[model samples]
Target: MKNLKPMLLEVNANPSMRIEHEKELSPGVFENVPSPVDEEVKVAVIRDTLRLVDPHKQKKKDRLDHDVSTAPEAGLPSLCLKQVFPKYAKQFNYLRLVDRVAALFIRFLGVKGTTKLGPTGFRTFIRNCKLSNSNFSMASVDILYIDITRRWNSVGIDHKESGMCWQAFVEAFFFLAQKKYKSLPLPEQVASLIDFCEYHLAVLDEKRLVCGRGIVERRNALVTCQTDGLQLTPAAHTPLLNRMATASKLADYRNHQY
Candidate 1:
């Protein structure tokens, strides 16, 4: 059985004429689609892109700057934005921060009684946020790999529960994302977070942490498990930590030979 598409047509010809026309129209599969060629044409017209290699493409705009295939109608050129601006992207620390913030918001949604956030709820909330990009660089705010291991972002730990909420929230994110498929339409909160991070540099970075309640109160207790986790030092930091031993050996060899 084929369902007829109800058309809201303006009738100047008269009600009887409209009814007669409706009756004449066949109620079948062919009438429903109306155009197979249009659908096929659309499927075939999928965008094809060329990958140009240029380290300094952003310095100057050229004739090929605008992707003409996509748009000749609009005058503005399609800006050659890099997918992962490795030079400008931040480190895992920034991701950790984002994960934490996601956690805090997710928690509020799943709280049972007093609106307190939990790990699972925060995780679900993040699932709903629908972060579009698979690559993390789109979310960073610093000079890419500044080694968050340094003692730079530790200030202002007393203002709000932001750090704590973030910590738990991040856990939930990883939990759900490991082996699950979230629904289609992503939630506005996720998009909002991504948009906010993409535009505002300081809010995500500790150096320029947003100086307000909305930004500050969105925190969580800095869980001990989360600490030193994103530090990409080594499978074991201890073996690498013993660099002095190798240096001393070289020094001993030089001394003995002399």
Candidate 2:
């Protein structure tokens, strides 16, 4: 059995139905008898077969999609900034900016296979970017990076293997830009900083530019809050009802003939 290859013979779709067999009684008289033992055996076989097919069915909690509260760190499909940041989506061309930034990021880090960026590579990329007419100075950029790092650490983000996905990168960019220009509104500040970065990136050499490596041009699925707008019943109401029943002196009353 171990040396031979197993071949699939047939598949029974409805295997749990009870089967009846004809039992000959006297000369030609026949009676149909249902076999409960055969039915039970069939059910056991089906259950054991399913268990063998899916061995990880009991460990579903360890899967990636089990916890929807946290964001994915690595191996994420290409994402658009609009889906991740819908509030500022209509204000600026985040799609284009994300692509441009991703191209530059790939070139700087020489990234291959995956679009994830580590902390050290991200810091190097930020330092290399020359922002013109922007409020962010060298010192301010370092401070912003530190703040974002602390935020990632607080959320228990693992930067050792997969540093930051495309979504995280765009989120960090918006956070840093928003912090630097607090007086301006969200749309204005983000747009202004994007313009400055775009002008600088536009003049760089196009020979080493790599497109669609880590980031793509499409919007990924959004993660929505499952518990939003839920109204839970108050426990105080239950206590109030119990108190009313006790006040009426009906707590020990019993009707046996009803």
lDDT of each: 0.40, 0.57
Off by over 4 Å in 1: 1-127, 130-165, 181-258
- 65-168 per-residue lDDT for model 1 (tens digits): 86655554345333333344444456433434465455345444543433334334433333344432454222331211122212222543444322223433
Clashes (N, CA, C under 3 Å) per candidate:
16, 0
Top-scoring candidate (TM-score): 2
In candidate 2, what are the lDDT values of residues 1-258, reduced to their tens digit? 123544443378765355577789889999989777766555555544554455334356567566543444234322211123455556655555666556655765555666566656666666555641266565665665556656655576555544565555667768756775779987667666667665655655342354433233222212122223132345537788888888666534643323
Error of 1 at 248 (Å): 99
